[model samples]
Target: MNGDAVRVLTYNVRRDVASDGEFDWAARRDAVASTLRFHRPDVIGLQEPLAHQYADVRDALPAYEWVGQSRNADDGDGEFCPVGYRRDRFERVDAGTFWLSPTPEEPGSVGWDAAYPRIATWVRLEYRRSGERLLYANTHLDHESARARAEGAELLRERVQEQRENDEALVVGGDLNCLAGDEPHRALAGPDEESPLVDAREASPHPPHGPSTTRTDFEGLLPDRQIDHVFVAGCDVAGYGVAADVMGDGWFPSDHLPVVVDLEL
Candidate 1:
């Protein structure tokens, strides 16, 4: 069998803070929801959504069931890196969250030179129609510290290698906070890394669609500044694109664009 086709979207939903003024989550929540709804991805990996904001997206996409936890240990009310999947398409075989720190098993642990705690959430699913297993992981690395980003990527790669079962297809997606040639990006997708993943954009047969950059900040669409990414292993990338849609008023749904990829696994 060629395996089942899966569509994945990785989005950094930009936290719901009042400082954004007109571009705050309150103003663009529906736009974000609509964007996800319109794309119809089988799985979505989201970063930077606060508890209530995650709730809004969850309520909006009732067809999807989600698994995640706040990155904070205190009251469990902080930014989340959640993984949501279509309930009818796959069965959740397993799921968990791990901090991107030297102490990965400890919740809310800060790693390297990071400005804040970072985490990766993952789920193992069984494609109902084919009984094929796939592992999908989502994360957001540190934005301010390059060292943190690199080490976090390495840690995630290690964890994925350790946990993934033999012959299972793999996918890793997120707003990785680094460009393609950067250390973090290389650590995850570079051939030198042990059991390295393939960047979906590079593996796809078709050219990437939309602007090159993934960060818009609700305004500028800089060229070749792409930071969002989706990487895979044991799959054929059928297509890749940067979802750069905006509202009629020209307001983007989030600061970062979603990276969408199609795969057969």
Candidate 2:
């Protein structure tokens, strides 16, 4: 019998605070919603989602239920690294949030020369059709701190290994802020690391055929680095690509196009 297939999208919906000029959140919110509605991924890992952005997208796609909190931890005030899953396809079994700092249990914490507070959100999902469970971890690494990124990779590696110890399927996706071959990427991709995580783009049988750059400067230029990624540990990767859709007054949905991957679980 064939295993169930799941579609995933990792997106950094540009925060509203930034002075985005013509491509502000207000202008692109609908386009982003429209894009999600069209894609309808079974699972979505999102970064930099301000509170309102989350609400707007949730309103647009009611079929999805999300679990996440701001990295700040006081409330849903700061940027969020959230995961959303289709309600009809999977059931949330467990969930939690951890700051990407020395004090991982604490909120709004910084680590290893990090400029901003960062955190990761994770959930355990049970596929209803097959009764198979998987661990999904979503995070956004610091943009400026190389040490934080590398250290954060180790932290996530531990999480992935934990899932492996349990013999569970797992996926990690988000905006790492470091491109392919960077220190953080190297740390996560190390073949010698405890059960090295495979890049979904590289593992996908279909291969990456679209733009390589996920972080475009709102101009859709081929960036020097493809910072956004989806890493998997226990699944059959089917397809992967950078979702680059130009809409809404000729501007794309987000500054960073989403990284979408299909997996057989």
Candidate 3:
């Protein structure tokens, strides 16, 4: 929206878990902080974020503002998706989350067939430069439930469509846990039956050197399969690419790599 294009990133930090067999929570925290510092994204959608982890990032980047609710309503201390952005560049207008089930009223309720509670955080942000406004929604789809993933995709599509009708630039980003060719991706991208509602995954160019944006911790080998993405609607994407920070120091800050995009309002 501003004369300066906004840079956005989406990452899933894997609940600060590391495969190195060394459970140094402090090191994990530092890794997360360093990753953010390296990219310096204007806005970030982080999945599997804990309150403590959020605090670390907030303290490290004092200028950024964030919002999100726990995945579980019971304070079970589990993972959740938290969205953060640089306040000086964008002003938050509204923010909230809804359940991924048929009865979406329950804020933190676990959806049917979902392995864990799923939530989508939505925020309305105003770009300071051009005085343009946009809506962003971030979430992690149910990793193990096919039904839940399909339904979640549909729900997100509907929400984005509603927001687009208001003539606002829209972008959705997150670690969807589904491949670019999956059903969930297709559903959100507007399955063949309707006009494409969203442009996701391959909508942007990927880093040239990394194995996709996701990797398994098996013996530290990097494999291919991009599960993280930045989706956009009602906006023009000027430039986009994935951040290959994982290739540094023989260690990955998280299981999933962060994706960044530059947009023109």
Top candidate, metric lDDT: 1
lDDT (Cα, 0-100) at 159 in candidate 2: 62
TM-score of model 2 relative to the true fold? Answer: 0.95
Q: What ranges in model 3 sit over 4 Å off?
A: 1-4, 17-20, 193-196, 205-210, 216-221, 246-248
TM-score of 1: 0.97
- Local distance difference test values of all predictions, in order: 0.92, 0.84, 0.74
Query: TM-scores across all candidates?
Result: 0.97, 0.95, 0.89
Candidate 1 Cα RMSD (Å)? 1.6
Report the lDDT tens digits of candidate 3 across residue range 37-115: 8878888898887777777777887879988877787653677678888988898888887767776668567776899
Q: Quote the positional error of residue 198 for candidate 3 in Å.
A: 3.5
At residue 192, candidate 1 shows an lDDT of 89
Alpha carbon lDDT at 54, candidate 2: 86
Which candidate number would show the highest TM-score if scored against the true structure? 1
State the displacement of the C-alpha of residue 219, model 1, in Å, after optimal TM-score superposition: 2.9
- Model 2 per-residue lDDT tens digits across residues 1-265: 1359889899998998558877888878898888887777999998998889888888888999999998885868888898999999999999988888889888888878998888889999999999988888999999888889999988877866765546677888999988877877777776665646888887888858578788777766566668999888778898888888888446687878888888888
- The worst-scoring run of ten residues by lDDT in candidate 1 lies at 1-10
